[model samples]
Target: MNKKVFISGSISIKKLPKEAQKSIDNIINKNFEILVGDAKGVDSLVQRYCASRGYYNVKVYSIYDAPRNKISDKFRFEKVEVSESVRRKRESERQQAKDQAMTRDCDYCLVIWNGRSKGSYANILRAKELKKGLKVVINN
Candidate 1:
């Protein structure tokens, strides 16, 4: 079976470095089905790249629809929406759900860490707790 990978990363696109961009490209080229939240920043970049490359199997899970940005129209993806109520709840539960979904659906979780964001840290903890294979891509 083809490997399925969940992509979690800094939403701050402006902070992404050249190395991080290349790493994401490499990962996408490996034919791993990508799972990401289709928000702004790195998520948007990855989704747009996959779409432009004709990667049909990419899936986006987000709390909202595509952001109001100018991503290319060619990027097509399956979207799973997480209800807003989940975000309003306790942080632990939200992180649990995110981790659960990723673990249940993906073979590996690739996290692009930008800095000291709490959400990113929570994801790291969740990945560790689930014992899923993780690849941490640091973009400094």
Candidate 2:
């Protein structure tokens, strides 16, 4: 059986860390079910790489009514909603919902992070709270 891997990372990086890319490539064969969000940055980078490689065993979840990248259409999708108060709504909260859902659905997470961004940090924290293992690929 294949493991379900949840992937997330920072938005600030224009280039992915070599270790993170290695981790991604390592998990992307026929033995993995991958999950990722539909947001930009790491999500987009992973999605593009997987799509280009014709990986179909992926789920691209996103918040309701949000436009995702075109390549994400190739995979299955789950539309999510934010529980935050509408009056205080923010895009980050919406993305949090999507990433949180990914956390809940995966056996573990691969955090492609540089150890500073909030979103990637939140994903690591959420996985820790869920008692799921997180393999962090720190920047070199």
Candidate 3:
């Protein structure tokens, strides 16, 4: 079976350079099921691209419900939302569940950021700890 790949990156998709988009395309052509956070930026683009190509294997695991934007809603990717409570204990548990799901579902992870944000960095670290392969794509 082809490995499933998780995509972690900046939410600012509009800011991505042309070269970065090319790289993402190349990665997607590898036939791995793409998993993304679908928050914004690279994740949103990846999901949209996959959906447009009729790639039903693509999925998005989000921390919250879908954004109110039409672009986010247009993508036909499967989305799983994790609940976040005001309570620290509940939030921690929710985050842990997300991490666990990511580890189990992803065989590899691709990070597309010049520098790491909290969520992207944590995802990379978790992938590493779980011994999943890692790929980093940078915009120039």
Candidate 4:
């Protein structure tokens, strides 16, 4: 079966882990459909590397019409609807809703976190709440 790997992370990480690169690369090479949020940091890095390598089975999930990162024009997207309440809230709240939506349809989630990012921690817990497979890689 084609695995749908959900990717989430902190916005402050400077480098992608080697293990992450290997796992993502393998997913791309094997043609697994990728589901990722359209935030900065880890999301951007993953999208950039995948686009550079011509990996096409990617679906960028976002709350706004446009993603925060520079997502490639070659990929498809899944936009999450922002509620009126969330519209009244902060950007992080809107982003968290998007992450929850993406996680709902994924088979497994790979989180690259620094252990202190609220967004990353929220996504990790959200995955567990939905009973989805969770794999966290603590980034330095």
The C-alpha lDDT values of all candidates are 0.65, 0.80, 0.62, 0.85
Instruction: Please provide, for model 3 over 22-133, each residue's C-alpha lDDT reduced to its tens digit, 9 standing for 90 to 100.
Output: 6557666787776666355776676666666655566667545553222444334444455445224564345445545766688887777657455566777788888998
Clashes by residue pair, model 3? 11-41, 13-41
Rank by lDDT, descending? 4, 2, 1, 3
Root-mean-square deviation of every model: 3.7, 2.1, 4.0, 1.3
lDDT of 4 at 47: 89
Which wins on TM-score, candidate 1 or candidate 4? Answer: 4
What candidate 2 gets wrong by more than 4 Å, as runs, is 70-72, 84-88
Q: What is the lDDT of residue 31 in candidate 3?
A: 70
Q: What lDDT would candidate 3 get against the real structure?
A: 0.62
TM-score of each: 0.71, 0.87, 0.68, 0.93
Candidate 1 residue pairs in backbone clash: 51-75
Give the TM-score comparing model 1 with the true structure, all chains together.
0.71
Query: Where does the lowest 10-residue lDDT sum fall in candidate 3?
Result: 67-76
Q: With candidate 3 superimposed using the best TM-score fit, by how many Å does residue 62's alpha carbon deviate from the native?
A: 2.6
TM-score, candidate number 4: 0.93
- Tell me the deviation in Å of residue 15 in model 3: 3.9
Highest-TM-score candidate: 4
Worst 10 residues of 4 by lDDT: 66-75
